[model samples]
Target: MSPTIGAIVIPVSDLESAKKVYTALYGEPHTDQPYYVGFNVNGFEVSLNPQGEGGPVAMTDVDDLDATRNALLAAGATEQSAPRTVAPDVRICVLADSDGNPFGLRGK
Candidate 1:
């Protein structure tokens, strides 16, 4: 399956403070949780990840999360996290390239 970037995650050290700033910028978040805050701006999802490092992560949408993750691993990407269900049908996992550039893969 051809995957496309569906979400952008920005790492924040302070969730509450970042929420305030993001609220002011994006108006209101569509998904607000202690771990993550997400805003939909002009059809693009921008999210704040409290557990993220200092770099931004781009989440790509795939048809099969497991297969795509395995492909990435075979292509030299390292696993950062195992697949986990975040929503009812949504599954997500993290990986990093050889240079340690982190990204995510999501499916439903």
Candidate 2:
């Protein structure tokens, strides 16, 4: 078995809108394929999957979520809550982007 992520799937309300957002952020699309537009940058391989419910609330782990939270805040993301323990092995904080989709960052 592989010890790393095979890939990630992100769902979006509008494929066109998501494509534009991801393109601006990542700076390039991973593939020339027309159906999906995205690429692997940094550690994440982002793909915009068109679907109904919502995009992913990425659970990121960091040594200092307070700092990470601050960064995200400065970039226009809103803090839904401060970091708190959810389980013995989990501590997480919720955040929402300008579009109101919720995502979390966790620390061990």
Candidate 3:
């Protein structure tokens, strides 16, 4: 399957405060928890992570996580975080381009 830009996760210092602002713009979040607050903007996922470092990271949905990540690494991308499951049937990984700009990938 072709990759699709499915989600963008923003790292916030204060989740509650950020939740308020994001909720105002996007309405109430579909998923609200201590670790994350996720809003659905149209079909795209806009998420907030209290533990994340750096700025926002856009996640691309892929059919095969390992193959795609390996290919990216072969093409000069570096692994920032190895693939791990965040929720049921949902797995994600963080990677950086050669210049060290981080992005993410999500798969089932």
Best by TM-score: 3
Provide the overall lDDT of each model, using Cα atoms, as 2-decimal numbers: 0.92, 0.67, 0.96
Give the per-residue lDDT digits (tens) of candidate 2, residues 29-103.
857354555577886756665642454556566666677778999999998768878458756677898988787
Q: Candidate 1, residues 1-98: lDDT per residue as tens digits?
A: 68999988899999999999999999999999999999999888899999888688899999999989999999999998899998899999999999
Off by over 4 Å in 3: none
Candidates 2 and 3, the one with greater TM-score: 3
What residue runs in model 2 are displaced by over 4 Å at the alpha carbon?
A: 1-56
lDDT of 3 by residue, 69-105 (tens): 9999999999999999999989999999989999999
Error of 2 at 93 (Å): 0.5
Clashing pairs in 1: none
Q: What is the lDDT of candidate 2?
A: 0.67
Order of the predicted models by lDDT, top scorer first: 3, 1, 2
